[model samples]
Target: MTTLKTESPFIALSGVSKTYRTGNESLPIFTNLDMTIQGGDFVAVMGPSGSGKSTLLNLLAGIDHADTGDIQIAGQRLDHMGEAARAAWRAHHLGIVFQFYNLLPMLTAAENVELPLLLKPIPASVRRERVAKVLDLVGLGGRGKQNPTRMSGGQQQRVSIARAIVADPSLLLCDEPTGDLDRKSADDVLAMLGYLNRELGKTIVMVTHDPEAANAANRTLHLDKGVFVENEQVAA
Candidate 1:
């Protein structure tokens, strides 16, 4: 694992631009956008539907390439790395939690959490240990043997979070993590995220439409038309 100094800016995007081309019509998402995020900080991003919030998350995840500019995370230049290299970097340094709880129907919760480790050269015993530990951390220690299809929406989302953190990634990117859950379930999930951020010191950038969800983070940034219109520290 790569140990990084937490005092510095863990993520930086400078003069970044991204656009999509479809049949000669250009759709611009971000232009000359710059942002920085400190390590071990939890930030929530809010924006309208077309404000490029999720696009920014995708850019940070290295799932999409920016048309221009430097994208650095943990002192690694993502804009300069090739697709395969970026994939390798993402596997080690990042974990992603999706809104829809993307769990495989064929696997149990434990098996799903163990998927990320399968790409590594870890021993079976170590993989099993990590999966169990993460599942327990997410309060799903007893649900490891259950299929996701048999679980509640909140339970499945917790399983998704377990899978994301099982690899011990330094950064976590969540996209509308509680969008599909009930009010109580959403609170539970948000509380868990806060716990992870506070206890594990995970650097988090969460894209959320719910103001209540954004309040869970220590800082909140509102994006409008690819620009950050407001940045505020949430009241403790």
Candidate 2:
């Protein structure tokens, strides 16, 4: 297991708040939340339904904006960045893995992994090289030609992970990445995430409900009523 390093935080949130509004009702998700995650640390966030777990991930990914306070990611202010700038920053600085594998059915695994690189001005040769490398890293080197519909749930999720990291993003945000997998497959995914954190030194924030999944991370934090309630350190 990797040691926890908090000398400098890679992600920080200060006094942040988020709310959803209906016709006449305002639903508050997070109120004055504060958190910090160190670089290269694997953190598991466990929470019940509607505890703002997903909302927290969205805020970190810059998919959703906060109503108040500051969100700093890799020394940049996500809370203050403009929409276009934030989208651009997110593309290069962070990668997200979803609960369901979000691969396009019509595209091959390699093609799907190449989507993020398409946003950059990288050369086609370099893009293909990156796509091939990440696929191989995720244990799907030869399966790159296969389509999503032809792969199993685990393989699909691995492909999704390949896509997320193909750009070599510094931070990885996973939202129930193994939620739809069997035990063995979930373990495989969790192990891969651990490798990414330990070997590659990529900072990871994963939200999961399974205690087994939480155990995979070095640090586990429980959230309830929009606030963190528990912080447990897992043994190596």
Top lDDT prediction, candidate number: 1
Candidate 2 displacement at residue 71 in angstroms:
0.3
- Candidate 1 lDDT over 1-236, as tens digits, reads 33344666999999999998999899999999999999888999999999999999999999999999999999999999999999899889899999999999999999999999998999999999899898988889878999999999999999999988888899999999999999998999999999888888888899999999999999998999999987666748
Tell me the whole-model lDDT of each prediction, alpha carbons only: 0.91, 0.90
Residue 216 miss distance in model 2 (angstroms):
0.9
The count of backbone overlaps in candidate 1 is 0
Q: For every candidate structure, what is the RMSD over all alpha carbons to the true structure, in angstroms?
A: 1.5, 2.4
lDDT of 2 by residue, 56-129 (tens): 99999998999998999888899888899988997887888988989899899999999999999999999998
Off by over 4 Å in 1: 1-5
- Residue pairs in candidate 2 whose N, alpha carbon or C atoms collide under 3 angstroms: none
Against the true structure, candidate 1 reaches a TM-score of: 0.96
lDDT of 2 at 116: 90
Q: Residue pairs in steric clash, candidate 1?
A: none
Tell me the TM-score of each prediction against the true structure: 0.96, 0.95
